[model samples]
Target chain A: MAAAVETASHIRAARRGSIRGSRRKALFWSYFFLVLFVVIFLAPPFYMLITSLKSSGEISAQVNPWWVFHPTLENYLGLLTEPNFVTFFRNSAVVSLCVVAISMLISVPAAFALARMKFWGSATLATGVFLTYLIPESLLFIPFFRIFAFLRDITGIEFLNHWWVLIIVYPTLSVPFCTWILISYFASIPKELDEAALIDGAGYIQMLTKIFIPVALPGIIAATIFAFTVAWADFLYPLAFTTSADQLVLPVGIVTTLIKGDVYNWGQIMAGSLICAAPPLIIYAFLMDYYIAGLTAGATKG
Target chain B: MAEAVMSGVRAPAARRSSLRAIARRKPMIAFMMALPLILLILLLVVYPALYSIHLATLNRSMKRFVGFGNFLFLFKRDTFWMVVKQSVIFACTAVFFKTLIGIFLANFVHTIPTKGQRKWRGMLMVSWVIPTAISSITWFWLFDPSYSAFNWLLAKFFGTAPIPWLGEPLWARFCVILVNIWAGTPFFMIMYLAALKSVPEQLYEAAAIDGANWWQRLWYVTLPMMRNIISITVLFSLIVTFANFDIVRILTNGGPVDQTQIFATWAFQVGIQGNDIPLGASVSLFMFPILGVSAYFILRGVRRRSQEI
Candidate 1:
């Protein structure tokens, strides 16, 4: 009986050990892939950073490519101090800020109305807003170019090559998504809060400013972040409409100005790209929750 | 006392009547509130969309009527056929890889304890947060000849010859799609993770209690619960990916015999640069049918989602 008891305990111990061993093996594979994915996802930017730190002469030399033999910050300094680069930076900043403001101004109230108020065609209008967001820039740029010219002829607005022209055009991209996100956000707000305000004879504007806006603050921040990113990162419109260096945004500016006659000033080029990327990256780093909320809400919440 | 009572009764009734008036005028109020956004959309989105169709019908100079002529011209060209095939391939491949890898990564991330998930997700989304132009151009530099990091790494491990990453037609197309997958997959990961969270834990527990294995639980419970989100995300991604311009434009610009040309870049090349507006407009219109289908699905998904909530 003692031997049988001992044998039974041994078998149970072995079974538990095997289960633990299998879990360990599963965890090992999971981390292995996780590390591998981190490297793959991060390699390009990491490489870009290393490349940016290397001097041009070092880059072209037959030397170790991964590590910087001779590091320098000339690329960053040079690009930053350059006049055209400054202009591009300024244009991107201005356009992004104004677009954020415009998108919020337009979307917040519209979303509130759609979410809270009962009106004819509201549902259809909501769908329309979504569909408009889906209409890609590629489809619009062509007609937009032609229309800009037509407007130039009729309205005397020199929109074809102006930096300010982007302000008018970018709302098309930002407003629909902003409105959609805001609508979902507004709808999700507890109806009781706003309903109580309504019962107290509060005006819609008062209810919006005093109640809905404060409650839906996270949603508003997400929308603003989204609009800012969209406007700042827009490459095609800047590339198409703005021909002169002075009018270019950072993306178009770097690509066009840095590459000159078959030679890529790669150090400076990578530096410019990284510099342009820093704003959004920094924003993402700090406000990741809001950013992710916006991204997922922009798609799934709708 | 009587006067005070009369005043009190009159005040509440008067306030109630005013509230009624406000509610009655809510339609006009809503309409007025929505007016600026409506006008903005009507001007920018609606007008331009209709204008694009009209532009497609016009000749290059915008003076002549050529209904269906430009589109017919496109149908006859070998390049147009290639563009159509290539666009479909690019969008479909990118979307497929993104969705698959996204689910995998999302599942992996989901497996971790909640505290670790955010850190891992932030790291993964690095590519997505960076502007596409910057990242795509970064890939362009990485894939540059004479010192391609990828080729060097490939040679190190696989002992292969230098890859013409953006030089060869097949590799160029593959590179573009790979970049799209890289940048796009994180979005799917986050969205899928959100969708996955909505799946009730009890379902999985019940499935396990019933002898359903890991795969079975995922297939029956997780996927079915996530169907709405999956469809919506894929549909939205399809539209975006189909109309994707930044990756192809920055990476190859439809070079190496225009092998990676999609509608956006092709339209830019032919219409804006080549000064053939009609052809460009016609090229861009090819995207509408596909997008229309995707949008329809997305709207349906949104409606269903809102209804559920």
Candidate 2:
């Protein structure tokens, strides 16, 4: 009996040891692949930084493209001082900010009503909102272009070529998604808190401001980040709508102005691209948790 | 005392009437709250979507109705068919690889210690956070035939010849799809990671107790648990990828004999740049059927998931 018991214990110990061994192997492989992916993923941006640091002459020279020998900030300074680049930056900022504000104003109240208030067709309306998000901006830009022209013909408002047209156009891109995110978020807020507020005679608007908004602040932040990113990063709308250098947003402006008719300005382009990419990247770095939460919530929670 | 009694009687009646009025007005109030959203959707999304269909029916100059004429014209054109074929290939290939890579990376990230996962995830997510337009510019420069950085690296280390990345048709298609995968995988990874975390740990522990190997556990436990998320992400990615514009437009501009033209770019080329608004509208409208089908599945999934919750 004693010998048998000892053998069983030894077997269990061996199994545990093998398990540990496999786990360690798994971990090692995980880290190896993780590092590899990170490198591949980061290579372009890293290359961008490397290229942005090099001078035009160095960029042209047949040497290691990855390494910058005589690093310079001339690209950065040139873009910053250039009026077109500055205008592009300003236009992007204004458009994105305005879109974010409009999106919130439109989506928040709508989300609240859909999530909490059982209005007529609220459920169908809620589903409609999600379905609307599935519609890509590429599909809409064509009609919008013509519509602007039609409007200009009728009202004499030059809606097609102006930067401000983007502020109107971008919300259609943003509102649906924002409303969807906020719906799920506001839905997730428990019934009791709102019930108590209702019992206390708080108005719908008051309850939203005091209760739901505060509780769902993280979701709000996430939605805001998404809105801002969409507005700031959108290429199609700006590319199609606003053509002139002064009216162009960052993405369109950088591509059109910096490329400049077959003579690709690599140094200045990289610098401008990097600078254009900064706001969204910076926002992501700071609010990554909210951003990820918002992203996952779309599929998982919704 | 008589005046106080009269006032008290009126107060209850007034309060009760107000309560009833509020109950009656609740739907109106909700409608009022959602009015801006309703109007925006009606005027912007729904109106433009329907307007595109009407626009597609018209002639280039918007004077004549040519129902199915544009589509018939597209049917005859080799480039239109190529756009369809390329769009399918591009969307399917990119989404497939993205889902595969996303799942693998999610699993790998999940294997690491909890403390280290955030750092790894953050680093991996950088590619996605950078705007596609800007990232595509970097990719364009990287793929420049004369000074392709990737070619230089390969030539330096592996003694390979420089590649005509955007100069050749097949290579341009590959480059555009590759960039799409790079830009998109992080989103899939992040989504799958969240799904992975939500899977109950006990299922894996139980599987281990059953003497199931790691692959069995992953196939049985992990994949099954993540089915809903996988489907949703894939479907969503499909729609986005099918309609993708920035990478292709910026990287190749449907060049190398227009081999890389997808619907969005082709639509832009035909409708806007080519100065045929009706045809462009028709080209873009081709995206609707596929988008509609996918959007249907997605809605059903979301509805089911919401119900389950």
- Could you give the CAPRI-style class of model 2? medium
Q: Residues A1-302, candidate 1, lDDT per residue (tens digit)?
A: 99999999998788667655654664566567767888899988888899889889988886667779889999989987899899999999998999999999999999888777756777678777888899999999988998898889998878888998899999999999898888877777766676678778788899899988998898998898899999999988988899988988999998889897788899999988888999999988998898678777766665
lDDT, candidate 1, equals 0.86
The weakest ten consecutive residues by lDDT in model 1 chain B span B1-10
Clashes, model 1: 0
| Candidate No. with top TM-score | 2
- Best DockQ goes to which candidate? 2
Clashes of 2: 0
Candidate 2 structure quality by residue, lDDT tens digits, A28-67: 9999999899999999999999999999999999999998
Per-model TM against the reference: 0.93, 0.96
